[model samples]
Target chain A: MKYTVIVKPKKAILDPQGKAIKKVAENYFGKDIGDIRVGKYFEIESSEPKETIEELANKILSNDVTEDYEVIES
Target chain B: MKVAIIRFLGTNCDYDCKYACDVLGIKSEFVWHEETSLKGFDCVILPGGFSYGDYLRSGVLAKFSPIMNAVREFANKGGYVMGICNGFQILTESRLLPGVLLKNNNLRFIHKDVYLKTEGSRCYFLKDSNKNLLKMPIAHGEGNYFCTKEQLEYLKDNDMIVLRYASEDGSVDEDANPNGSVFNIAGICNEKGNVFGLMPHPERAVGHLGIDGEEIWKSLLE
Candidate 1:
């Protein structure tokens, strides 16, 4: 089995890297752009159950205080 | 006091910490991350570096090291534990300390000497320090600390905040905040004041690179 996990900074927290990239993107495209948020994507292949994958996403992949994680079974 | 400096893969500051201990006449030794016991050590120091190459996040991977279990047990037993720079990140990641360190507001790695205003009343690590304002070097990209508003209030209410970025005259304000840390926090102690973590490299200061970190390292003495 393979799992995909996506981790992103919480909505309330300021994402400085995303903001910097947004600025450059707007300059290059020369158009008003909506908010740009950056996140991490990870793919894991394991025989572990989905619960274990969720736990990994929650415990190691993302910081609860600053980020959120979603585990997708594949 | 005997100090055990915890060394994780890519931890480059362990030697500097050992040197600091030697200069202070404090017995110190390097304990690899695989060691499972923290026995016979009065203090544990986690020095700064890009542990695990900061793969997932700074200090995130290092938290799973075998030695961390010993560190947690030691800290829970009320033994003195201190984390500096990247070590600070690890403490937070390990949930030994509250909050998290985010990337700098400017999205840049900051390396420089900054003034610190000591503020905690219950920190064992600052008990012997006489200076309220001191200059120390900080080098990190993700040193901007953040926590929920409720947690921040609790930290303030409990006097857990140990240090804040400040001006030379000891005024703490937004201008002095290098990485946009909440309330300009540069260091904090656990609720019991035994476990302390800070973004600045106090060991590097001890009059070697520049400035005297005596206020910090000296306070660890028995």
Candidate 2:
């Protein structure tokens, strides 16, 4: 099975890289987007069960204090 | 005390740490990250560098190294463990320390000397200073420390905040914060005060310009 996980900084936390990207995009978009939040995507392939993959994603793939994660596809 | 500075695949600060220890009159050794045992060492140091190419995130991949288990065990036994720069990131990922290093507020790598003010505690890695103010160099991109407000409060209430960014005259304020770290924190210790992590490279500032990093190693004997 392959799991696609999306992780992003917690909403309350500051995302400098995301902000920088947003600034650049604005120069080209002409203020089409409101706020830009940057995040990372991970795809993990494993033969293990869903529970195991979920556990792995929770433990190693994301840090709860600063980032949030979700299993987008499995 | 014998210090074992663990060198991960991309660790570049191992020699600098070793040299700093030598300057403090202590013999140190560089141990590869694959070792499973840290039995005889009194202190373990994870030096700065682009460990594991800083792939997924700074310090993320390196935290899973085989040597980290031994480092954790050593820290659990009350042995001193210090992590600098990328090492600090690894420690936080391993959950040895709280919080995470976010991208710099300016979204750029900062490599310059800044003043550090030690909080009013006599930590093992601290305590031999002139009013606890010293100049140290910080070189990293993802060094903006982030944590929950409650966690920040807890760290402050417990004196876990070891060092913070400060002005040249040792005044800590918003203007002195180089990386937007909460509470201007540049370094912190675990609740037990055994494990330590800092974003600045004390080893890099040891032998040159003002020579403040030596006081940290010299405090090991105190």
Candidate 3:
């Protein structure tokens, strides 16, 4: 089975890259533009069990202190 | 005492660290990352560089090197271990130290000389120093340090915070914070104080560069 892992900075954490991009986006698309947050997406072609994949996402793909990750079967 | 300077795949400062050791009259050797043993070594220094190309994240992949197990064991056994710049990131990734280093708040790679105030630590590295302020060079993008609220309290209670960014007059404030580190922290030691990590390059500050870090090396050797 293939799995997709999406990692994003935690809500309480500040995303400077996202903020920098958001400023540029606002300059091009009006000041009312929505907030933009940066994140990492990974597609894995592994036959590992769901639990194993989850562990990979939790331990390797994302940092628990600053990032939140979700795994989806696709 | 002999110091073992561990060289990772992308480590560029191993030679610089060795030079510092040599200038200090301390015996040192370059140990490859794959080596599993740290026998006969009194201290270990992890120098700074773009290890593993800073892929995934700074020091993230480097933490999996075969020698980290031995480094962990050595640190756990009351051995002295110090990480500089990228080495600091690896220590945090390896869970040898608390907190994490994120990108600079301004989102830029900052490289310049900064003032550091000794905050007192249990470790011998910075203990009993006459100088309260020292100027050192820092070169890194992900030197912005952060931690949970509870972790900050624990660090304070244990005197784990060893260094903080300060002004020439030794004032630590938000304006003095170049990288937005919590409490303007530039360095920290583990709870036991055997392990320490800092974003500044003390090795780079010695010799021809500057002698501000000479006391740090002298105290560590003492």
Candidate 4:
């Protein structure tokens, strides 16, 4: 099975890398930039069931304190 | 108080912590991570460094060292314990503290002096401290602290919230939070208030090394 995990920081928490990138984009492309949020994307190949993979995502791959993750079939 | 600094295979700050204790007129010893005895020490410190090359996770591997068994026992007996930077990661991995430190939000190693606000008035380490704002140096790639909202409330209710980051002008500002730590928390004390773990390096702050590191050490002794 092929799966993709998208991990993103929770809204209440600040994203420094996202902020820095936004600053660069605004400076170079003029101030009409749309929303841009930085996150981690992981693509994995595994024989485990989808449920097991989701558990792994919650347990280790994503920090539940300040991050949320969504799994998609690749 | 006699202090013991744990030296794991890759610890680089054991000597620095020893020197800081020496300046405080406290006898400090370096305890090998494999040692099982923590006798004759009132406090034990897990100094900063890339323990186990930060392999699986910062401090994850070091938590299994034999010394940590003794350290945990000592802490359970009401002895003082402190962990800095990588040490903080070890504490969390061992479940001594509440949360884990993820990579910096910026995805880059940050090294700078940041201001921290004292969270309470009774912590033994920060007692009788005049300045509410502390300027300390922080150098790390995995220092973003995270915790559940329930845990955060519990810490606040129990007065475990120790030091929080502040702006250059000593004001609490969300934008000034360096590593995206929730609640702007830079450091936290265990529920007993004896164990403390922080990302900032007070050892690096001592002397005229540019910031008031000596005074901070003195406060702990006081």
Candidate 5:
């Protein structure tokens, strides 16, 4: 099965890269943008069992301290 | 006492660490990451560099290397293990130390001399009294340390926090924080004080900078 994983910086943590992009975008978009948060998207193809894939997502693909991840479209 | 400097695939500071060891009169050598045994070694150092190209996250992939299992066992058995810069990130990611190092708040890769103050820390690496404020060089992009509130409290109660960015007056204040680390923390030792990780490279600062970083090296031979 294939899985799409979305990893994002935690809400409490600062995302300076995203903020920099948001600033550049606001110069053109003129205050219409709500928020621009940055994150990582991973498309993984694995034949492992679902539990194992879940473990991979939690253990290897995501960091609990500064990030959150979601497995989508498996 | 002999020291083992574990060299990961992308490590570039192993030689500097080895040099520091030599200048400190301690025998040391490069130990490949694949080696499974840390037997007969009194100290192990995971030196700094862009290990695994800092992929996924700094020190994330390097934490899973074959030798880390042995490193973990060694640390658990009250052995001295230390990580510097990129190695520090690896120690946190590997859960040998608490918290995580995230991108700097200003999103800049800072490389310059910074002041660090140590206070009553029981880490084996620090030999001087708590009053010394050392000027050391730090080079990294992702070094902002964060943790849960309870974890922060636990760290405080146990005196796990060993180093903090300081002002010229030796105060740890918001303006002194270069990387937005919580409480301005630059280094931390494990609960047992055996495993240590820090954003600054003490090995690189030895003998060339303000206060010789040899105070840290002196602990290795003790």
Candidate 6:
């Protein structure tokens, strides 16, 4: 099975990369830039079942401490 | 105090940590990743680097190393353990410290000197001194700390909040929070007060090399 792991920083945390991009945008396009946030996406193939993959996502794939992850079957 | 600095495959700060400890007059040893013992050191340090290539997650893969079992045992026996940068991630992954470190809120690697406010006088690693703040350098892409609301409340209630990011002017109020950490936390101690994980590189600050590094080392040694 193929799994797509979408990992994102929990809300209330700053996204420094996103901010840097925003700064770059402002530098090029001039101020008036708006909000920005960033996240990561990963694709993996596993022989494990969906339930097992979900558990893996929680236990090791994604950090529940500061990130929330969702799994989509491909 | 005798110190053991764990050396995982990709750890780059073991030597630096050892040098800092050596400067402080502490005997230091490097324990390999597969080692199952801490070798009688009173303190163990997990230094920073791209451990396990930061592959599965920063420090997540390293958490399962054989040496970590020994680390867990050491912490259980009231030994002092510290994690810096990648080390901090390892501690969180091992469940030795509360909260997990996520990618920097801005999503880029940050390397700079920042002010840190000491939360209280209870952490063994920080000594029981009543100092109010510390200035140190932090370099990492994944240093944003996260925990449950109840965990935050518990840390506050027990004074486990060790260090907080401060403004450039060294004021530690809401506006001074740099990484948007919950309660502006920069570091924290375990309930036993023995395990400490901080995002900043105190080793980098422990000399004339940068801001009051020598004093920070002296304070830790005290």
Q: Return the top candidate by lDDT.
A: 1
Over B20-127, each residue of candidate 1 has an lDDT whose tens digit, in order, gives 888788899999999999989999999999999999989999999999999999999999999999999999999999999999999889999999999955888899
TM-score of chain B of each: 0.98, 0.96, 0.98, 0.95, 0.96, 0.93
Would you estimate the TM-scores of all the predictions? 0.98, 0.96, 0.98, 0.77, 0.96, 0.82
- Over B58-90, each residue of candidate 5 has an lDDT whose tens digit, in order, gives 999998899999999999999999999998999
Worst window of 10 by summed lDDT in candidate 5 chain A: A48-57
lDDT by residue (A1-74, candidate 5, tens digit) is: 98888899889878888989999888988875867789898888988776776688799988998889888756
Q: Tens digit of lDDT per residue, candidate 4, span B1-222?
A: 788899998999887787787766867889999999999998888999999999756887898899999999998888888898999988887778888787787788999999888877345567656777788899999998888888989888889888888997878888878877778888888888778888999888865454555545665573
Give the local distance difference test score of model 1: 0.92
lDDT of 6 by residue, A1-74 (tens): 89998888678656677778888988889884896776778788999888987887788777776678898999
- Which residues of candidate 2, in runs, are more than 4 Å off? none
Interface RMSD for candidate number 3? Answer: 0.6
TM-score of 4: 0.77
Candidate 5: clashing pairs of residues: none
Better of 3 and 6 by TM-score: 3
Pick out the ten consecutive residues of candidate 3 chain B with the lowest summed lDDT.
B213-222
Assess each prediction's global lDDT (C-alpha) against the native. 0.92, 0.86, 0.90, 0.82, 0.87, 0.81
Native interface contacts kept by each candidate, as a fraction: 1.00, 0.77, 0.69, 0.38, 0.85, 0.77
Query: lDDT by residue for model 6 over B47-114, one digit each (tens)?
Result: 99999999977999999899999999999999988899899999989999888887666566888888
Interface RMSD of each: 0.5, 1.1, 0.6, 3.7, 0.8, 2.5
Ten contiguous residues minimizing lDDT sum, candidate 4 chain B: B207-216
List the candidate 4 regions with Cα displacement exceeding 4 Å: A1-74, B219-222
DockQ each candidate and list the results.
0.95, 0.79, 0.85, 0.26, 0.86, 0.48
CAPRI-style quality class for the chain A–B interface of candidate 6:
acceptable
| DockQ of predicted model 1 | 0.95
**Residue-wise C-alpha lDDT for candidate 3, range B133-199, written one tens digit per residue:** 9999999999999999999998999999989999988999998999999999999999888899999
Q: Where does model 6 exceed 4 Å of error?
A: A1-44, A71-74, B128-130, B167-170, B210-222
